[model samples]
Target: MGTTTNIIRVLFISILIDFLEFTIILPLLPKILTYYGRDTGINQDSLYVQTMSFVQFIQNLTGAPNDAKWNSVLFGGIIGSLFSFLQFFSSTLCGAASDRYGRKPMLLLSMIGISVSYGIWCVSFNLTIFMLARVIGGLSKANVAIILAIVSDSTTENERNRAMAWIGAAFSLGFIFGPLLGAFCSQWGIAYWPNSTMMFFIVPAVISLVLSLINIVFIIQCCPETLPIAKRDSKQTTITDISNKILPWHLFKFTAIHNVKSVDDIIILRRLGLASFLYMIIFAGLEFTITFLVYNRFNWNSMKQGKMFFIMGLCMALVQGGYVRRIPPGKEIIAAISSNIISHTNQDL
Candidate 1:
């Protein structure tokens, strides 16, 4: 029991750090895009320039407002989408690999990749390099899923729900603090070295890098292998298997779940999966673009954006911790429907 408690604690901290590093760039995206877009010395024929040109062309073709603010929003959306796209595949691959190997090894490998990504960001002077950093970060973002797996491996069925709720709390806390920390670092850099453009971004990247490195060290020294050898899945996951897992058709059909024996259960799972997919689509679109919208409309600097995220995170934490977990099991659907209706109605108003 003591070991299980310690393992859960480590998993919680690991996830918190992962989200903290991930969200640090949220409030800074608009400014980051602006900085990269205005670099006059970058070669016009380079990949970065070409990509930016294509984005600008799309914006112009779509008849979007011709201004730096809106353009930054569009560019930020593209970057955000690109990250999600890579993560979509990499997460499946990581989960499969973890099943074959142990969870600890795969978790370490993902953390290493994430740490290297932040290291690259620290030196990213151009949009191309910055995009590369995002690519690496997205591909390495297997921490959350793996941490949940670890919790499942370590906890009993009765304790699992509570443990997962704590994981949700970690996420909320990360979002609450990470953006504020990033904004503070940016402000500090600007105050001390107002002329240094590199320092403005590098400060946040450096902090993220340091946190990831610390996480890596903590895992190496403290985290134990949660999956026992007898329970391990020894099958080699092939390219075809991976392709099947990630492909939209197979995913929508719930083909990866081999244990469900009943047709009705499979149908229910598919419907639930589809609902989640649609919800995430709407949620992600708003999430990625909200910073840009606020910046454009209110001229919000990093600190103001950070405060907004803090409030959003705080509200989410309060709701999840205080109300969401206490709902009776069968009433989840009703609660979800009610929340969505209220959310959309509020948005309309």
Candidate 2:
């Protein structure tokens, strides 16, 4: 029992770190890009330059004040999208690899990959190196799914939802603290090391790197293999398996076809997946847009943006921690679906 408790504790910290790494960039991205843009010798034809020009044109048409700062937000969005694209492919492969080998190996590898990327960020001097870090870091995005699987393995069905709630709470807390820490580190670096370029972004990245390394060491010392040999998936690696790992669409087919026990289950799962996909499409656009909107309207810096995110994280934490557990699973699903439908309808109006 103590072992199980330790595993869950470590996994929770791992999840928190995963989210912290991702959200830390939210407040720092514009500043990072603005620093990148000051290079007068950058090629005009480069993708980054072209993207900035295009965004500037859009700003002109919208009657918004033309500031080089908009370039940073747009460039950041493109890099973030690139990360998401890489994550789409890597998630399937990592999940499958875990099933074949064991959870501990995959978790350790994923954490190491994340740490290495952050280390790269700490030393990166150009856009190419920074984007490379984003790509490598995003490719290890399967840790959250693995953490969920681990929770499933460790808990009884009755306790699974409660464990998941705590994980979600940790996620909110991570976001709450991540932006604050990033803002603080950036300001601290600027105050003490004004000559160092990218210190604002690099310091936060270094902090993330240190936490990841600590988490990796903790897992190596303590986390045991939860999936026994008898329960482990076959280790066979066929051509189809390889293809499934590379193609994101194949993940949908793999999960739906292999896991669905009934026609009703298939319908329900597909509907939920469709809803989630549509919601994300809209959410991504809104999330990206709001950053630019707030920046243009309020002339806010990274610290102010971090405060905004803190409010969002605080609300999410309160709702998940205080309210989610009181509801039954069946009712929760119904409420979620109903709320989404109403949200869509209101947007249309």
TM-score computed on alpha carbons, candidate 2:
0.87
lDDT of 2 by residue, 186-289 (tens): 88888889998767887888888888888788788877788887888885788876786565466544441565567787677667767777778777765555
Q: Which stretches of candidate 1 lie over 4 Å from their true place?
A: 41-45, 60-63
TM-score for each of the candidates:
0.94, 0.87
Against the true structure, what is every candidate's RMSD? 2.0, 3.6
Instruction: Tell me the deviation in Å of residue 224 in model 2.
Output: 2.2
Q: By lDDT, who's the top model here?
A: 1
> What C-alpha lDDT do the candidate models reach, one value each?
0.85, 0.75
